[model samples]
Target: MDRIKEKMNSLRVEADESAAKVEDLQKQVKTLEQENLQKEHEITSLTHKNSQLESEVETLEAKVKDLKTAADDGTGHLTQNEALQRRLQLLEEEAEEADKNLRETNDKLRQTDVKAGHFERKVQALEQDRDQWESKYEEMSKKYSTVQKELEDFQAEIGNI
Candidate 1:
């Protein structure tokens, strides 16, 4: 009976531990969601910048095309056109690199979401296990009480004899 009580105590401790672990995991998931929000904000900013750069590049390209269509053989116009073309290329590359970075950031956010989901599942399972352990502990306590009462009744009868 002493061993049974000891085991019950140990199970109660385990249930407490499960509760603590669930709290910890919930905190981690909250932190991860916060971080993901920040990253999304950053992605939005980068996307806006990329769009602005693309518009500028498009305008520059149109101007260059118009100048070339005019067939101006002047060296200065040619030089200016060449410079504009080079600027457009550089802008396009910058936009491409920014897009690539945005893709990578999105991938990272998805992975974080997956991890958060996993943590949540773990917390749920732990909570259920804790509940089961508590139920078992309660059942054991009732049994122990019944057994103690029976033992007391037996002692009383012996004393009467």
Candidate 2:
């Protein structure tokens, strides 16, 4: 009887530990989900900025093409040609910088995606663990209740003696 009581006590302790672990896992899952949401938002913002940069580059390229055509025609003054060249150089530099930024953003997005995937998998695993622990806790609770009832009946019989 004492051994049975000790077993019940141990099971109760194990159940409490399992409950704590489940709670901790739930918190971790929530945190990961929030981080995933933030990363998604960042990706959306970066994509929008990339599109704007692409449009600007296209417009600048068109202007450069027009300037090239004007320079081809001997009618433009030398000073005008020099000014156009300077403007084209500046535009090209800006376009190059924009492209570099876009590439960096894309890389960051990819890394974020990977991290999100990893977190999702981890959450799934933790959820599975929590479920298993819950099942174990239920089983232990049932056993504990049964053992407690048996102990009560045994004590009652002893008291009658």
**Per-candidate local distance difference test:** 0.93, 0.93
Top TM-score model: 2
- Write one digit per residue (lDDT tens) for candidate 2, span 59-93: 99999999888877745577678989999999999
TM-score, structure 1 vs. true = 0.41
User: Candidate 2, TM-score vs. the true structure?
Assistant: 0.48
Q: In model 2, state the lDDT of residue 89.
A: 100
Local distance difference test, candidate 1:
0.93
Predicted candidate 2: what Cα RMSD to the true structure?
68.6
lDDT of 1 at 140: 91
Candidate 1: tens digits of C-alpha lDDT, residues 32-117:
99999999999999999999999999998999988786666667788999999999999999999999999999999999999999
Estimate TM-scores for all models: 0.41, 0.48
